[model samples]
Target: MELALPTEILEDSRNKGVVTALYDALSRRDAEAIQQILAPDLEWWFHGPPSHQFLMHLLTGSNKDSSSPEFSFVPHSIAAFGPTVLAEGFDPARSIAWVHAWTVTDGIITQVREYFNTSLTVTRFSAAAGQSDCSIATLHCPSVWESSLPGRVGKSVPGLVLAI
Candidate 1:
């Protein structure tokens, strides 16, 4: 059965859809698709540990190493306020959670702010503009060490920060 979402939730869902589409494009290495979603002059800021910087390189195709492994982002929740879409990325394998704030204008993403391992702060400030800060949702996992498995070991630490 199709359950209808409220108008506000539907808008938030649409914004989240954009983010999901962007991630899907990146995962497929489809530059053309990414170009369609991002503004001509995109501004991004990432705050976290260094290991996560690969996201920038990946998006920009700066890392020429073909052997680099592919990574995925799993968003747990998404909310929208004005032109901003705030989503949470939960990486259970690394016991980490990141919040991404994407600002879209005319269906194009113009700016992005990523906060890794800072879900608490991100959620606190994700309330509607002019509204007092309110708590946001988070994803929970039982085990985050799966990424450390023998062959699955990743070079990047459990922490990460990337901006473009």
Candidate 2:
């Protein structure tokens, strides 16, 4: 069954499109495509284990100093809340999962905040924040989700925690 995004998210088409295109470019491992979507000076932040930070290089295909393994992330869900877009990406082969929140402005992706293997924990906050009834929802705020990945059951999905 296909899940539907909330109406509020649907209303913000431009940001949503930018988020979707960014993921699509990453999945294709198309550096040129990614560059087109990202801002010239993108601000990327990584949270969690130190190793997880390498994801920025992976996404941008810019690990020239070391040999980076090629991997694909399938986004299970995507939602746009205001200028930020939240997505859950999972690599079934490696049993790895992550939630990425992209901040888009003027058709360019300006910032990306990635949380590795911590979708469920952060999702709980979405419910409490009352952003939306959907599994994930975005809010127009600065606070981001912070949680550990453990005892998480079922498929790895991304959720948005809105502070509004």
How does each model score on TM-score?
Answer: 0.62, 0.63
Candidate 2 segments exceeding 4 Å error: 1-11, 59-68, 120-151, 154-164
lDDT of 2 by residue, 12-74 (tens): 687988888877887777889988999889898776567656566686546657765665666
lDDT of 2 at 73: 63
In candidate 2, how many Å is residue 33 off? 2.0
Task: Provide the global lDDT of candidate 1 against the true structure.
Answer: 0.64
User: How do the residues 1-164 of candidate 1 rate in per-residue lDDT, one tens digit apiece?
Assistant: 99877886766667777888887887788999999999888998888887766567777776677564655665666666656776676666766666777887767899988776652332222344555645444322222111111222443434432211
Candidate that would win on lDDT = 2
RMSD to the hidden true structure, all candidates: 8.7, 8.3
